[model samples]
Target: MKRSVLFAVLFSLSLHAFAIDTKLMVRAKAKDAKFVGSSIGGAHIIVRNTINGQILAEGITTGSTGNTGLIMKTPKDRFAQLADDKTAGFLAVVDISEPTFVRVEVISPISRKNAQVHASTELWLIPGKDILGDGVVLEIPGFVIDILTPNTHQYIPLESIKSTGLDVKANIVMMCGCPIEKGGIWDSEVMEVKAVVKKDGQVFGELTLANPSRNLFEGNVKIDGAGSYQVLVYAYNPTTGNTGVDIINCVVTE
Candidate 1:
């Protein structure tokens, strides 16, 4: 009987010494916008052990963009919950014997590689403790700028280009896919959009894009006998220090 009791006690102690599964929730929030979710291509989440660089958990956030009123409109007090059960997040359960320092990385709007922004943070996680409810919110700053004109690797006749200047256009929106319009939530008036033009690796010129409609910025670039032209369209919100860029290459046949 004593031997059996001793063996049982040892087994219990061994189990206690083993690692505990801790729950961690990670979310990607677009700066000045909302959560990065399935509608705009969910954010890729990676949680790693900072000391040994071991990836503890890896997954993509899934769900909605979250409540806009709570995230954007409402005045937030201390410890206000901006996310709900449906809010997009990646829940990771990590097994750790003791407190471990971890690095959390998020690549937002994963579908749009051209406009994807990376954000990361580090914190110590205690065993058996779960960080849920709004979790670790990492803010991604930038706009999603997609160049609409001068399609990627497009070839245009030299005569056609000379007749009319190149029309540069882009679709600009917040990283969360929030529409940027005049006097809207994301005001376009406060942002600047431009297209940097280049020819054969030489600086050609730059054009200030004007917003003619919601989420659309357009400009005209005077092609100076284009030869292997490249256009990079970018959007910058000076007030928020947010910016994003998308590039396209086209050839003007001589």
Candidate 2:
């Protein structure tokens, strides 16, 4: 009789050890006004059962004007095995017995030119161990942009740009060097700027804005330098008006 009781108790504990709850959040946007090629502005959220690598549930959000958001939930144990893999990019994992929700964000850019202007959603997930029973935490220090110019007039400081739904605070630094002849220029007339969210200091999500060049430059600018420079962009809280800075570095070649 005692043996039967012990067996049942162990079985219950085993089942509880592998349980979990998960959630996801997502957003996306476009960079340029032209919106050329296969640039479909949309966001998708997914939850997978890590034990067997099976997709449990998925959701999507999209917009033509350039922004979207979504939320989802699932069991905690569904991703327990996946948490052990460093390359998995799992931000946070909850206890198998407790209810957990993992939030995810996906933001796609319209083009490489747009990527330079906004660089939206480039924040990465910085994983840490020994917390919440070996789970991951999300961190986003912000996005960075590097600009190379032929002269000081071409410099676009981060503080000069404007963003929707987020505040802008940026750090700009100039490196001394000579100018490059016809090498530091892009074909696009306008560029898009993007901002992504960071849980801890790593990028977890992003958003892109159209025609960022209007805010960055007042008139036609030229690049004539062979040095390096950096521009940082931060996620601003629209309600609080608090600004965060993202960083970008650029190299000009002669």
Best by TM-score: 1
Candidate-wise lDDT, in order: 0.91, 0.30
Model 1 has an lDDT value of: 0.91
Task: For residue 185, give model 2's deviation from the true position in Å.
Answer: 33
Tell me, by lDDT, which candidate is best.
Answer: 1
lDDT (tens digit, per residue) of candidate 2 on 1-254? 99999999999989866655432323232221111112332224344444454444454432222111111022336444212222212222323343323233332222222222222122222222123322322222222232222232343333332221123222211000111111222211222334443423444345443323412311222333333543334333233232234444443333
Error of 1 at 123 (Å): 1.3
TM-score of 1: 0.89
Poorly placed runs, candidate 1 (over 4 Å) = 1-17
Give the local distance difference test score of model 2: 0.30
